[model samples]
Target: MKMGMRKPSLKKSISARTKGQLTRRIKRTLNPYYGKRGTGWLHPKKKLYNKAYQKTTFSFWDLFK
Candidate 1:
């Protein structure tokens, strides 16, 4: 067997608690859903949707009445 087919593993010296904390921190910084308006939070498509939501005033009753 060659090392090319083997998967890499972290050092056993690192504790499980440290690994969990690191993963949580990494997720917090890299997540797309946790950012502010100027970050990845807002986009052109979202703005268009918001505009449509605010301006739309259609009523089915008006047409029938």
Candidate 2:
């Protein structure tokens, strides 16, 4: 398991910040349970993705970057 900050992906960083807003908005609008409780079961892949993302990513507040 990756125990520290993930290797940066230029494409992921740029596109994640720039694109997919509409998709996010649409998902939130269509699903009342979106981003809320029981999402792990409802979307196991998303849950796993989030778990891995959290483990491997860093925040803006991180001094080391």
Candidate 3:
């Protein structure tokens, strides 16, 4: 679990901003459990890691390069 600044990746950041909308739309269309609550149960470990990562890590302006 990374606890401080997140390692930066331009590609990942760019993908996050752009891919979110399209993938969300696709998930909403094709995934039966897209927006349902408690759906994280399907992938508890991944969900837990992401939750921790969000709370514990942050990005620095210079880290992008």
Candidate 4:
């Protein structure tokens, strides 16, 4: 047998399935907030509001001024 050869274990397979399910659930939950539509969480509209809330610095002043 090769030193690095190993049989796949049931635990690994189950864990992989569980992780996949969890990822799907998270995606579904966050889909409305971060989907491809223009109204998602990271959408430009939302991002603009976030930027407005951020503390402006000299760099922004130069850019906006």
Per-residue CA lDDT of candidate 4, range 1-65, in tens?
12322345778779879996788778979775534555545468767765554433233234556
Q: What tens digits encode model 2's per-residue C-alpha lDDT throughout 1-65?
A: 55665567778777777676667778899988777876587678887988888877776447565
Write model 3 residue lDDT over 2-40, tens digit each, in one string: 899877889988897898878988999998889899898
Instruction: Judging by TM-score against the true structure, name the best candidate.
Output: 3
Candidate 1: give its CA RMSD in angstroms: 20.3
What TM-score would every model get versus the actual structure?
A: 0.25, 0.57, 0.62, 0.27
Question: What CA root-mean-square deviation does each model show from the true structure?
Answer: 20.3, 3.4, 4.1, 18.7
Error of 4 at 39 (Å): 17
Number of the top-ranking candidate, with lDDT as the measure:
3
In order, the Cα lDDT scores of the candidates are 0.54, 0.74, 0.86, 0.58
Q: In model 3, what lDDT does residue 16 have?
A: 79
Tens-digit lDDT string for candidate 1 (1-65): 12222232455435546886787678788985553456533577876765565455433333566
Which residue segments of model 4 deviate by more than 4 Å?
Answer: 1-16, 33-65
Model 4 CA lDDT for position 19: 93
The runs of at least 3 residues in candidate 2 whose Cα sits more than 4 Å from the true structure, single-residue gaps closed, are: 41-61
The positional error of residue 19 in candidate 4, measured at the CA in angstroms, is 0.4
**lDDT: the better of candidates 1 and 2:** 2
Over 4 Å off in model 1, which ranges?
Answer: 1-16, 32-65
